[model samples]
Target: MTGWTEYTLALVAFTASHFVPRIGDLRGRLIGRVGRRAYFSVYGLLSLALLVWVIVAAGRAPFVEVWPQAPWMRWAPNLLMPLAAVLIVNGIGIAQPFTLGGRRQAVFDPADPGFAAISRHPLFLALALWSLAHLVPNGDLAHVILFGLFAALALAAIPIFDARAQAHFGPDTAPAFFRATGLFSLAPLANRSWRKRNGGRLVKRTAIGIILWAALLLGHTAVIGVSPLP
Candidate 1:
């Protein structure tokens, strides 16, 4: 239970930072007053700061072994994080009205839904993947609690966000949007039609994802005090 108080407080603060902004029209009103870029920038910094506190506090907390360290476990994040990074890079600043990264651009044609056709909630999926991947290597109780909640929350947010999208677009329009995209479908990736339309953009984003993955992998030990290498 050592340092548990700080860990718990940091976790609560981090969680509240996200949900508080979205309560009723708080986020909308904040954006109205402070502009979208400023609002997100401040929110992002606050979230990042709280996240760092949570991680540091977890490190200071009592270590209770849930599973013994295995050389093989380290490979999970190494293998999965690149895909997660790809999802993250592609998901950011997209025009998919059905997901978190939507509201950035003004245009989103359900007909040519781009990446949304493959996964409507790529960012959420990426978060789930990243958290789960880390959980494989981090078998301590504190790390488990930290990453487990993150994995659960990210997975839960997908359907919640989708429902919010439906509410926003209304019954008449939501069905068509749902028909055009999928929550977790990979069919679009294999489809010739989607490939013809979004292949170039996908390739470009994948390259960026690879670069991001490399940067994180190289920076992990310096930033987090552990190498991600298996």
Candidate 2:
């Protein structure tokens, strides 16, 4: 496709992915209309399809390198991506009260000490970091625009979603919710909470994240067919 076509497609996909959830309490409405299981299935399928299209289109778009990356920015991904991975793993593995599992009282308690000190939304933070890191290295118009859009969405969606969540759940419930998942919201307080809860499990996840980061750094050329380090 032409550059304009590629840019348009990328923008459309990114905007749809970010803005769809904000449409008229669509998430709750979907759950109420189709039931949880069916809603999740449909949502997941549509998201996956959009993601696949974005990836394929990104690969086909002609890359016009905008500028030479600084040494620091090029290397920053090595550090940030690993941290991002750790956050993602911890968010998935930890039974925090802000998560669906923890919220339902399935695995952890709301008043648990660990859950009380950590941000509930580590996964979103992880994704945000990954997007930001890539935005630094990928200087092409399409790449910058696409990754930049994700970074903006990840940052913006946190507070908007948090407010909506608090409204739906309750004002009294906000503290625990914030404590459990505030990291995802881009609040300084949440970062402090996350640091306080940095335990052995978090360290182990960091180690795993390091390994994943190394793999990505070494394999970026092959997987993405571009030498990021160059």
Candidate 3:
């Protein structure tokens, strides 16, 4: 198959793996039939396979440069990646867990929102920032498409999930959960409530994030064959 064709299939599989199971009664049906553990096992492996395929195919695809390599822009990834990692850790918890185990947000009171007051969809922000961080530095056609698709998906998921939440939890409830939250700055940093609420957690998270960032910095060359540190 052609590089474009392989890339297209990889992209489709990645997107479908995320959506097809959750959007409809499909997830329930599978769980009922196979049991949640088995279903999750199958689903997890499939998703991982598709993700690996995407990475491999994207790397192998025709490298048409979209922009001249600017090593100066390497700083962007360094900054953005750590921030992205932090957001990812914070995002997939409390109200919005990304994994199958934390799928149900019903037990968790949405009213308290916690970190979600920063952004209704921190995972989306993480994914988008992660994509953009790499997208800018890579400067190749396949990578541009790969990261661009992910960023677009991340952006699209915000409103889509919001609308779904409204439909699931009633119109008033969804809006209420997001009262102080936003896509970016629905909750301003200057707000005393925001500062008071997130302060301690932010400090702890920063410590963890720095460790993660350092590992990434040191591992970048070994993993991606590129040096991200200055």
Tell me each candidate's TM-score: 0.91, 0.71, 0.82
Flag the better candidate by lDDT, 1 or 3. 1
The Cα RMSD in angstroms, rounded to one decimal, for candidate 3 relative to the true structure is 3.2
Q: Candidate 2 clashing pairs?
A: 119-180, 120-180, 120-181, 120-182, 121-181
Please list the C-alpha lDDT of all candidates, in the order they appear. Answer: 0.88, 0.65, 0.74
Q: What is the lDDT of residue 16 in candidate 1?
A: 92
lDDT of 2 by residue, 1-230 (tens): 67568657866975686468759988888799889779867877887778666765766678878765677787767768777876666566456533422333434344543532455656667668888888887788777867777777767766765676577558776666555544534343345544555555656766887787778878988877867663
Model 1, 1-230: lDDT tens per residue? 54988888888998898888778989999999999899988988888889889999999888899999899999999999998999999898767865777765646688898888878888999999999999988999999999999999999988898888789779988888889888777788788989999999999999999999999999999999998898
By TM-score, the better pick of 1 and 3 is 1
- For model 3, the local distance difference test gives 0.74
Residue pairs that clash (backbone atoms under 3 angstroms), model 3: none
lDDT for model 2, on a 0 to 1 scale? 0.65
lDDT, ranked from best to worst: 1, 3, 2
Q: Distance (Å) between predicted and true CA of 16, model 1?
A: 1.3
- Native-referenced Cα lDDT, model 1: 0.88
